[model samples]
Target chain A: MPEIANTAAKVAVAMTVNGRLVSAELDPRTLLVQFLREKLLLTGTHVGCDTSQCGACVVHVDGAAVKSCTMLAIQADGMSVTTIEGLAGASGLHPMQEAFREHHGLQCGFCTPGMIMTALDMVARLGPDLDEATIRENLDGNLCRCTGYHNIVKAIGAGAAAMGAGAKVAAE
Target chain B: MYAFDYQRPAALADAAALLKADPEAKILAGGQTLLPTLKQRLAQPTALVDLARLPGLSAIEKTAEGVAIGALVKHAAVATSDVVRAAIPALADLAGLIGDPAVRNRGTLGGSLANDDPTADYPAAVLALNATVVTDRRSIGAGDYFQGLFTTALEEGEIITRVDFPQVERAGYAKFRNPASRYAMAGVFVAKTADAVRVAVTGAGQSGVFLWEEAGDILASDFSPAALARLELDPADLMSDLHGSAEYRAQLVKAMAKRAVAKALA
Candidate 1:
């Protein structure tokens, strides 16, 4: 159990994060972003813009990519959440992470976590046959000021293929 | 964010009870807008009645008349729903265009309609499609739902159950989004029903989402983009901001209406 709120307005929340069942007592007003970063120490989900415009805090809530900044911790009670840290298996980096590394997809790496999380979602939804235009369109939510998106787009396309192959390997 | 008591009632009836018990309680839908508002201290509620656990409130079901989307249905769900695509492709497109993917995954139909932000996309669809907003207490016509900017006809304790959209002959929606924020600068939804034609506009009006009666009347007789050639919106009734001038929005209204009519006919 984690204690994220000291106030009397604390509410109990139990949720799954990164394949672990974590429970905490937090303020009813505690945002999911704060719960993840301050309480759970999952700082990989960055908070670039507090206004929900920047997708740096994007994470999977019950398998859908959502801005953690805009959601309350209590809202996620009994839900499954996956942050950027959860992408890799015990063996090595996730295929998407490998694709980004191979393609030089990051610059400052601040937006990489959110970008990777968003890419994982896109690959899951659209499958491996993602075009440049679709990738660009889908990246509308995540903003990266450094890479100019050329390398990031390439990384996502390559990552999509690897993820598809990875799924096939597991299925086999 | 201000401290508040959180309540997650398993049943809608229990949720309504909690709401009725606490006057300062607010219904927490998807929390895309409400949470941000709370974080900014724009609103202070004594309690938040979480409706996420309410089972039937999130379902998308086809009715005898048309499609009924549960109030808790997220924008992404609506955007990707097969039923919505088959019954109302325009609606799906509109849902897809709302905010971004992450925002869409969390923003709900009920929250959007309940908040009734002037620039919101759903109000235009509700108005143009002549949908029925079913609430816990009673049903409200789409025409009567919206009152003004950030306002709706819903009572303090009323909870929206679902929105029922009738099967129209054809419908289309188009919007010019503000690039930075993605809020609609000017959005229009045009629908041709069995008995009448409706044209609704969101984002451009100072008084909030409004019906373009002049264009709707013209399209009722002659439903085509060319039919709007003689029609023009009064710039005085439109909103002017840094993104666009009143005159520009007036022109956009006509242009978007034309495009919507074309899409409906397509």
Candidate 2:
């Protein structure tokens, strides 16, 4: 909520990330991508483009997926963010990750993390009715130079189905 | 990006005051534009006013009049919000069509309107919806808000607080997306208000967005795509680049406008 202050001003920023509180004293110009990669050593988020064109740097801010490259560390102050590394638990890989592995959705695996994060958000909102057109429409933002999106779409469907089945099993 | 001073204020007044104190400082919303520009060294601000900590800046409120979108609300939030999807589907459509997943998740409507990129989709919505751009100091209407390409009425350090779109009878959005960037090659927004039909075209215009009076006339009379075919697009006003020609974009504006009307009427 900070307003525009004098150019000489500096401030401390703190954020709760992946259920843990982390604090940093950073230049206001430090991007959230730099902070995550260079500072916190969370290299799970990749930087594919200097511009915001690629979805490689996507992360979750307060449960909402956002591009980390387009954000500042200070902007995340007092906020909560979830990155790719945070998706897995002691139980093992998140359902989306397992599905990607099973589906051969990745070739080089560079875009896998961002793709998985985006899939998690899309499945939660779109449910299983996310047909081919819907998946194409939804994933237009995340680019894949390897062009491995055909399987990626299938993987997302399989993952959502698995998650749905898991929910059903628990309910039963 | 070079290092600079950063401040986070938890209140609106404090943020406004800080902006008032430092005109050179840039207000950070989603950073989808600012960060990239910074990395490109196109824009270098000595100070950064981080607005993410401010409360009530990300809410989508449904009022009796219309819908109010907070300035800091992400494009993804607006595109998926129940109220926006129901009240102003074109706004939601425009929000959903922005760059891509990452861009939509971090880009804000306010930021899009403020940036005034010719290829940006929200300007068409702002003009067609006739929304009010409310800033820290005053409110500006869509008619006068967008000056030209990559230009807006906002003074240095001014922050857009909320955008208020008055309820219209029917509205829809249509776009011919650029293959590589996914930005609109030409996008049109058509809205039928109680008083008159408003048509706005973006991406294919030289001056960013322009009023499509002929298309508006067509909508006012028939409100259909077939009616749109009768109106002619002047080649003088269309934008041209690697993606399309001025004449090509002019035709697309008409085609997209027709499609938008068809969708709206449907």
Q: Could you tell me the lDDT of residue A145 within candidate 1? A: 91
Model 1 DockQ (Cα-based) = 0.53
* Angstrom error at residue B70, model 2: 2.0
* Tens digit per residue, CA lDDT, model 2, A16-127: 8788899987667777888889989999899997576678888888766777888877777788989999988899988889999998989988888888888887877788
Instruction: TM-score for candidate 2, please give it.
Output: 0.93
Error of 1 at B61 (Å): 1.3
* Regions of model 1 farther than 4 Å from truth: A1-7
TM-score on alpha carbons, each prediction: 0.96, 0.93
Error of 1 at A61 (Å): 1.1
- In angstroms, give how far residue A59 of model 2 lies from its true place: 2.0
On lDDT, the leading prediction is 1
Q: What is the lDDT of candidate 2?
A: 0.83
Cα error, candidate 1, residue B54 (Å): 1.1
Candidate 2's displacement at residue B175, Å, is 1.0
- Which candidate number has the best TM-score? 1
